[model samples]
Target chain A: MRTVEAMLVAEVVARLCEEANFVLEENIHSAFQRGFEEEISPYGKEVFAQLLSNAAIAAKNRLPICQDTGIVVVFIDLGQDVQVTGGSLYGAITEGVRDAYQRGYLRKSVVNDPIERTNTKDNTPPVIHCRIVDGDRIKISLMPKSAGSENMSTAKMVNPSKGWEVIKEFVVDTVERAGPNPCPPLVVGVGIGGTLEKAALISKEALFRPVGHRHPEEIKAHMEDELLDAVNKLGIGPMGRGGRITVLDVHIETYPTHMASMAVAVNLLCCAARYKTAEI
Target chain B: MVIKRVNTPLTDEVVQTLAAGDHVALSGKIYTVSDAAHKKLVQYLGYGRKLPVDLSNQVIYYAVATPTPPGRILGSAGPTTAERMDDYTPALLGQGVKGVIAKGYRKAEVLQAMRHHRAVYFGATCGIATLLSMYIKKVRLAAYPQLGAEAIYEYTAVDLPLVVNNDIHGGDLQREGRIAYAITQGN
Candidate 1:
């Protein structure tokens, strides 16, 4: 068994926290540029240009692109072959997040209560998902989910009879209803099958895929393409200014479900898709 | 409803000329508040208490931000979803609030309030934190010190960009944009 030191996890998480907040990933950048070139709406084109400019300024100046930095969500893949030596894995990751927010001048968004909400000062105790895998390396993915988009995510458990048409309609309807709210030209992650919770998890996990990448399964990938075409046709445009490109991409992931259940989850990631990954 | 647009760094003349459906990119003094502060302000106004800052012709950004480290003025201080403040919006607009900066759709009552008050609602691009931060020149706390990010802080912004989602004249850009873009073929 390979022993991964807790400090290594902390260090990686720390670096990831800062990088995710400070930089818009290159994939998203390139995707926006593509959107800019394809956008017919003069307003949409201008908005894309400004978005590119916004990213550039943020990267060069080490500033966050948006004011809502968001809640920290970390997914860890620990190979069964790997054991964390020294300190708890979760503790280290949380500490890393806490330190990164403080050191990188990122905002601490975690609050104490859902009712009498109050900021917790340090962005601590991130919503972490740990999975045991087959390899020896430890993989960590950080996604800072902004409230604007996260608030709009939806999930439905349909009867198996509801089938593909229902799924597509629901997904399309969700995006249509979302309109400019989730920030148009959105990256939509659809998780089909699985249990109710697993569907939501995979939907979010699917968002970590690069902006233009497609799922490996041919059928699933085709559905993604079809969904993309439909959503873009909605013309929510860039920033919902009314353009041809309402959705930049649609990613779908699925798992076999119980015969009676067909769980559908739609997770929306806005243009500010802030995430970073590291392996140790 | 009459719809329009206003570019940022607005002058008072531009603000006054703004009719319904006129979308504006606003600059200058925009205050930040969220659910907690909104409740406080409403209560204070009920008692005829003077606000920390005069809200006349001012814009309020519906947001709850993370705390920044030492030396930095603020941290990812982007607008939160505006619909959450629907309950308090009409009251604030009644009290001379000229505009709102946020993300997402507002309730029907909020839209009505915007029409009645001749106020506008603008949506900053969602998740664009770094981009939005550059426009904020300074931050000054005004109320609800205990709320941390939910505190009412005044922000001086320069060319703080936004798109008209719901204009004063009752044009809903988000609604129109969706219908305009709906897929028909094999949709």
Candidate 2:
């Protein structure tokens, strides 16, 4: 069995926290250029320019790309043959997040309770999804979900009987209704099939995929392309100023489901698209 | 395509002159609110109590800024989703607030209130936080200090960028742009 030290995991998490917030994913960074080039609306063009510069300034100065540093969500893939030494895996992750937020000057957004709403002061106890997989390494993928776009994410139990058209309408409608609220141009992640919660999980997982990268599954990938075309045709544009490129990309993930259950979820990521993965 | 320079506290003439699709470089005093503090302000009026900070003729930006880090006057700052404040909006506008800065659309009632109050709604692009921080010169707690970020804070901004969204004559930038672009596909 391979042993991974708890302290090392903490350090990686802290680094990932800072890097994800400070440096946007490269695909998202490039999408801004494409957004600038393709945007037809004069106002849309201006938004693209600002978004491009916003990233440059954030990266150069080690400043957060967006002020809403966001609620941190992580997915941990633990190899079945690996053992975490020195501290609990959960403890290490929480410590890493707490240190990163304070040291990096990112906002602490987690509230202690849903109703009482007291600030945790430290962005700790991140939403973590753990999986046991083959291999001797531990992998961590992180996405700091901004409230604006996160608030706009939606899920519905769709009917496969009605087919792609039904799923297409729901996803497109969600983006249309979100309009300029969550900050467009958007990266839309769609999960079809699986149970309700599973659908939700994979949809967010789909976001970590690089922008403009097609799905490996040919059928699902085609759906992604069609959805992207339909959403762009909405002309919500960059910053919703109305243009041809409202959505930067649409990513879809599918899973086999129970006979009657066909759950669909759409997770929206703003242009910043801060995602980082680390292996230990 | 014309960009205007707007200073505050805004007068009726300034508010009336603005329209959708116009860009603006806004400077001067502004107040910021998170949803929590906004609820308190609206509740104060609901109970017929006086607010600690008067919003009359003043613009209120719907946002919560990050805490200042080393070597910065203020942390990265930008607009939050505006719809969360929709419940508190008409009350603020009715109380004579003239300008609102945020990203996204306001609800139907909020839109009506904008027209009735002759107020202006403006949007700053989302995710441009660090860039926008360059324009904020100063910040201080204005009221409800106990609420932390939920407390109202006053800001001094110079040439902060914004686009007019909803204007007094009933011009709406997002709606107009959305309709124009989507309709082109016969969609």
Candidate 3:
């Protein structure tokens, strides 16, 4: 059995939080570049140019790309064969998130309660999802989800008879309703054929995939392409200013569901598309 | 389609000439307020109580900036969604707030208030906080210190960039821009 120090996990989480906030991932950067080139509207092109420069400025200055530094969503794939030492895994991870937000000067946007709405002061208790795998290696992925795009995410349980066409329509309609609100050009993640909650989880997990990477399944990959084309055709553009490149990518993940119900969830990520992964 | 460089404490005359789709680079002093601060401001106004800061002819930026790091005037400062603050916007406009810098659409009531008050709504590109922070030279807490990041901050900005989405004459860039580029896909 391998022993992974909780301190090490904390250190990695801290670095991931800071790095993810400071740097725009290369895949997202390249996607933005492509969107910049393909954008037909002069205004859209200008918006993309500004976004590119923003990424550079954030990196050079070691600053957050956006003020809403976002609620940290950490996905952990822990090896069953590995045991955590020094501290509880959950405590260490939360500590890392707290230190990152404070030390890195990222915004503490999380509140203690949804209704009372008191600031948590230090961003803590990150939404952590952990899965135990067979191997002796652990993988940690962090996605900082900003409210602008997150507030626009939706999930629905559709009648199974509504089929794929309706699911496609729902995704497009969600983007359309989002308009400039979700900060298009967007990265859209669609989760289909799961339980209601599972659909939401997978839809969010879908965002961690590198932009433009396709699902292994040919049919799912084709649907991603079709959704990408359809969303772009909406002409919401960069910053929703109007152009041909409204969506940078569309990702879909699916699971088996009960025959009577089809659950779909759409997770919209803004152009920043900030995330990072580390494995040990 | 013209780009205009404007100074803050935006005047009625300047706002009148502006139209949707006009790009603006705004300099001078502006105040930052988000949902919490807006709620307070509107509540004070509703009760006919004195506001902590004067609003006449001031530009209000809808932002909740991150904490300033060492030796920095401000941290990442970008627009939050304007729609969330729609309920309180009309009251602020009624108090002579001249313009707002934010992203996303405004409700009809907010637009109507802009038309009535001759204020403009400027759309700052979302998720570009670090870039926008460069324009902010100074920042100070104006009110609601308990609110932390959501506190009202008075910011001195230099050529902060934005696009006019809604102008005094009922021009709506968001609506117009989407309509211009929207393609009809067959069923």
Model 1 stretches astray by more than 4 angstroms = B1-16, B19-25, B65-76, B185-187
For B1-187, candidate 2 gives per-residue lDDT tens digits of 6779999898999998998989999999899988998889999999999889988899999888887887788888889989899999998887889999999888988988888998999888889999998988988889999987767989998999999999989899998998878844553
What order do you get sorting by DockQ, best first?
3, 2, 1
Q: List the residue pairs that clash in candidate 2.
A: none
TM-score of 3: 0.98
lDDT, candidate 2, A71-130, per-residue tens: 899999999999999999999999999999999988888999999978899987799999
In the range B72-133, model 3's lDDT, one tens digit per residue, is: 98999999899999988888988899999999878888899888998999999988899999
Q: Write the per-residue lDDT of candidate 3 for residues A9-28, one digit (tens) a residue.
A: 99999999999999999999
Native interface contact recovery, all models: 0.66, 0.77, 0.76
Q: What's the CA error at residue B167 for candidate 1, in Å?
A: 2.9
Candidate 1 achieves a global lDDT of 0.79
TM-score value, chain A, candidate 1: 0.97
